[model samples]
Target: MPPDALELLSEKGSAERALTAALASFQEQVQAVPSLDLAAVVEAAKPAFSSGIAFSAQLVDVRGRHKLRVIVMHAGGAEVTSEEWADEVDDLLQAAGWMLAMLLGIPLAKQARPVEAEIAEAECLAVVGVPDASAGPEPSKKEDAAPVVDLDVALEPLTPQEIEATHQRILALPQASRQALTKAFREHFQVPRNARSIGDRITQHQHAAFIDHFLEECEEQSLDGAAAPAEP
Candidate 1:
């Protein structure tokens, strides 16, 4: 295999090993919680020349009623330093672990200790290419002010009543549906928790597009639930 392929294979192996160890630790930590049962599978391949790491985890409760699919991606170059690579993989594992913990109502900080140390030690040899901070062209006022003009007709600040109404709508969703919507909204807009207005992170046109998509999803879910036969 070529060097990059070999390096990716090595990283994949390390990540799998760390995940295995972490799963054991996670199981032990959750043993005391009678209501929680969790399992995870980490995919074994990290493709060569890939720009980032991507993985999927399936989480299910003991009775299998609540199932969650988690997909995580961390962006970085193929030529990252060993420390950066370790950090990236560790971050993925920790994220999966924490998500599982949250679903099980387990305390993440208290249970993730052992796996954290194990992941920290799985280091390899590699060189990272760092960009030169001073090499970029100077920022011009024209470039900085261009967005203001573009968004002048396409965006408007939300009124307090509108924000409150949106919050109320969100609060009316079932817990699982609410969580899913909240996560999707946050990821799509890349906004902080305090950004209550749709226009705070996107143009008015974009906001309307997202609202349409969100409502469609909600409607689909409602139809699915209605179609599903009542559980025993």
Candidate 2:
């Protein structure tokens, strides 16, 4: 864990309790709203300025606890035709991302917490423009007119290099060998994405709770060793 992460654990149990309450509270608020839709909100947000954009969200586990992470699809939308307009759009997206997190019961960084969002222009292309039929009849070539929205975000937990290295290590070993390692991991590892490092195969079998129990057992053993009498 990083230094900051260790500090974060100071409030771990309390934070989890808070998050559970927040999730319930936010869900009620969302259900009560007369008209609140993420997709619609995103669509409405597109034209306020000049950039083409998309949005999405996902759940992430931070130190064995579930957290909802926001992914802002497109980091920077189309070239900033206007610096002021671009800045405004950037602000809007950042706000929207946090707003979603608040609604979903997740606490993000005071700074910026970006995660992979499941958003993009269909077929892997940046959507170039919002639909505008005000000018005249809609063009037959729709792709050229409305750019597909792509929203993606990057966050910490594991880096690409680290993930790749873990994957490679798993792949190099036999399936049984890999499975055994993950079993041990499930029994002993308490780190984030360790089982995932090997591949989803391990994560599928290992629960975070199991890892927690293993850590407790290790701590008990360490304490026992420390209290033992010194032999001649």
Tens digit of lDDT per residue, candidate 1, span 4-37? 9999988866665444344334433332222112
Local accuracy by lDDT, each model: 0.37, 0.34
The top-ranked prediction according to lDDT is: 1
What is candidate 2's CA lDDT for residue 172? 32
Pairs that collide in candidate 1 are: none
TM-score of each: 0.27, 0.19
Pairs of residues clashing in candidate 2: 73-151, 73-152, 74-151, 120-150, 121-149, 127-147, 127-148, 128-147
lDDT of 2 by residue, 101-165 (tens): 22232222122222211111111111112234664675554444322232222222334233323
Over 4 Å off in model 1, which ranges?
1-154, 192-212, 224-232
**Consecutive 10-residue window with the lowest summed lDDT within model 1:** 121-130
